[model samples]
Target: MRRLMICSFLLVLAATANAAQPIRLGLNYPSTGNYKSEGLELRRGALLAIETLNRQGGVLGRPLELISRNTAAREEKARANIEKFAAEGATMAFGGATSEEAIAAGQRARELGLLFFPTLGYANAITGHDGQRYLFRETNSAWMSARVLGEYLSWHLPNRRYHYVSLDDNWGHSMEQALREATRSRDRARHGFSRISARGARHEEYLAALKKAASSDADVLVIVLLGQDLVQTMRLAHDLKLDQRMQIIVPNLTGSIVEQAGPQVMEHVIGTAAWTWRVPALVKSEQGQAFVDAYIAQHQRYPDSTAASAYAIVQQWAAAANRTGSLHSEKIIKALEDHRYSLLKDEQYWRSFDHQNVQSIYAVRVRSRSEIMQDRFKQDYFNIIHRMDGEAAAPNLDEWQEERGDELSLR
Candidate 1:
């Protein structure tokens, strides 16, 4: 009888200990799709952060573990992934390589009442009309990118005629609208506009479409494509000698693109990035240098903007959970909203109203091969044109709310 009681007590203790095991962090990214490279980078960044946090004894006496799924960049797949995460007892979830997937994940997050951080989904609606208290965006929105890029364009090439080659999607439309609004006062005339399908279009099709846009008499050609499409467009432009015809402005640029395209193809391209591995201000900072070094040591390549954002998101969430002393959704949300931390360049915080992380936006110009090779930092492939303040770069959500009236539902 004594042995039986002792065994029962020990079993209960073991069960309780097992129940208090590591906190599971869920990630849903398209591991096998058009955005696979970006998704892999996101995973790498998140894993690196988790590894570092665990090495430091993790947060609140609990080590962190990551459980990831492939979303395939599909909305339904994203929703299903979110449900799976919730079912798997994830403390919090983060992912969404594309805006469409992010938006879908955001909607599901609201339904699940789980804390979600969407990394590298630049659509404004993720935090705009589709925003819920459970959803927080860790990437720059279309409006933010447009505002910064527009201001730069107006200042540098004012009164120039412009042509637009945009992707036929919500993100592309949002970017186009924001750019039009931002450059309204400038003496600009739309010389031409072409919308390309983002869903697996042939390279020859894109090349032909771009050739038409490049044939325009505009002083600048704005390419609003992402991922391999952007790479293909730039390469096609180079092949067609479009780069020599007019200034190419890529509103939504990332370090991965610059790396993939190389300095020769990317030379003289002006763009805005939420974050970049080569930003001098970031590289010079102690925290930034540590992140870059750690990322390189782990992955053997410098981290891109998406990777940086993913890592920052995980670190920020861990910090918030640690500070609040709980993984509860409400507590984490409150903690994240109130927290201000410096991960990259300047101090950044999640805006209480919209839950968008207000961080510096880099206006970068891709350097020539010669310039990059001569630079001290191997990743210094960009000439930092300007560091747009986070607050200034972000659109006025209050005004946006006022404009939307009752349509804007954030809760």
Candidate 2:
């Protein structure tokens, strides 16, 4: 009997030891779909963060593991993935290529009591009306991007006619609305607008959108589509000679998108980014530069804003977890809220009211094909025409409250 008791105690100790293993960091993102390339970048950057953190002995003396589920950029898939992550013992979860995915996944995460940090969701509603205690957005909102881009438009291209070809999704609508408000072109009739499905859009649907925009006689064409869809549509736009007739603006631009669509296609396109690889040197951030170096060493390419966001998500979460020395979601959320951080860029912080990461945003114009090809990797993508501070661009307290529609004292 004594011998049997000793064996049971040893077994229980072994089980406890197994339970003390590394914390699982869940990544629910699209692995297949229009945003597959973006999803790959999220995983790549997160892996690099995990490697660096493990090398440094990890957070709170525990190693970290990345567990991801493919969302295919679908809302239902994202919600289901979050539930799976929670059931699989994920301490926290983060990943979303689109604002729709982020918003849906974040809501589900809240229901499951998991802390979620979105890697690349840009709609204001992610941290606005749809936001909750469980969600923390890492990217700037469409309003913020619109604010910076609008300033340049106001000065350079006042009174220009505009046409908007946006995706029929949360992000697309948010960006289109924000840009319209920014440029003071609220009349959809005066500024022609067209929208295609975010996923599974037919070839003719894209061609039809461009043909309509071309016939509208607009001086500026704002293209809010993304990923493979953007690449396909840009080629169609070129075929329709829309690129030559209308100046193009693509919000939330990334180097990956530019790289996928050759420099000739993306040439002269204007956009905004939270962090381009060149931003590190532009901002004189050594840590950011180191991350760039490490990323290049492994991937042989410049890290785009999406990748930077994924990296920042991992590092920031680990820091918060370490600070609290507990894996409880509430404690970590409180630790991250209103915390100032400087990583791949200059000073940035999580806003207390909405949990949006506030930082500088840039107005970037794609370099000409000739200028881009002159680079070593031919990845010279943007010339920063202007920069705007986060504080100046993000929604003020009144605006946030109006959007949130709640009466709660500042947390």
Candidate 3:
């Protein structure tokens, strides 16, 4: 009788301990698709953060475990993966490499009532309409980046005639609209916008269009396309002898683009971004250096925007979890609203209204390998293009309610 009672007590204690374990976090990303490289890097960064957090004794005294799923950059795959994650008891999910995939994932997440953190999808649909309760994007929206680029162009290159060659997708369209509005508000004649599909062999057609536009006296070329598309487009432009004819500006060019296009094609191309692998000494605070060093050590390579976003987001989640002492959605959300934690030295803090993290912008001009080797690089992108105040970045609740948000019935 005594042995039986002791065994039963031990079993109960083991069960209780198991039950008290920290909840698992689900990470959905494109692990086997066009953007698989970005996904792998992002996952590596996320794991680095998670490992660091756990080493520091984790949240609520229980170590965190990740439940990862791959989307393959396909809508059907993403939807299926989402369901799989949900069924596997994931409290939340984070994803969005491409615009279409991200939008679909966001809409589905909202429909399923899961808290989804978007890493690097620039589409506006995620947080555009009633994105308060479920969706939290630590990344800047397409509008945010577009507005910054517009303001910068207005100030610096006011005399130059700007022609836009943008990707014809949700992300590109939203960004184009924002850029168009901003440019038109300043001076309509200075800027013009055009569309191009990032996928397929539309390069010659687009190049011909660009050539015609240039012939009409367009001076500056602003390209809004993905890394792969940008590589192809730039190569085509270079072959056509069009690049040397115009000043090129690429807003969302990644390190991967440079790697793809090689040193030759990327030269003289200026880009705006949220983060980079090369951290300048002037901007390298202890925290920033630590994050950079940690990432490099873990991944055995330089960190890009995708990696930075994933790491930053995980840090954000950890901070929120630690502060709240609970992984529950409401508590974590409230903790994020406080914005008291320092996720990184980049000052990438979250906004309460829209739940978007307002981070600093960097303007980088592609340099030759020899120039890069000489370490003669400017740390700041464009001498502080725009310090987007979080308050200004905050979307109006009433305005959001009017635009499809009001109709969203999230029960």
On lDDT, the candidate that comes out on top is 2
lDDT of 2: 0.88
lDDT of all predictions, in order shown? Answer: 0.81, 0.88, 0.68
Superposed Cα deviation of residue 395, candidate 3 (Å)? 5.3
lDDT tens per residue, model 1, 1-411: 999999999999997796569899999887886777888888999999999999998888778899999987787898899899999989888898777888888788778888889986887777776777888898888888878877887888888777888888878877877777776633334456788896877887788778777667777888888888888889999988888888998987777777777778989899888776655354467777788889988877778888888898899899988888888889988888846877766688898888888888877788887887776545566667877788898868676596456976567
* TM-score per candidate: 0.92, 0.94, 0.85
Candidate 1 vs candidate 3, lDDT winner: 1
Clashing pairs in 1: none
Clash count, predicted structure 2:
0
TM-score, cand. 3 = 0.85
Clashing pairs in 3: 363-381
Tens-digit lDDT string for candidate 3 (337-384): 738444454455666666666666655577765664454322112222
TM-score: the better of candidates 2 and 3 = 2
- TM match of model 2 to true structure: 0.94
- Runs in model 2 deviating more than 4 A are 1-20, 406-411
Worst 10 residues of 3 by lDDT: 376-385
Candidate 1: residue 125 lDDT (0-100): 76
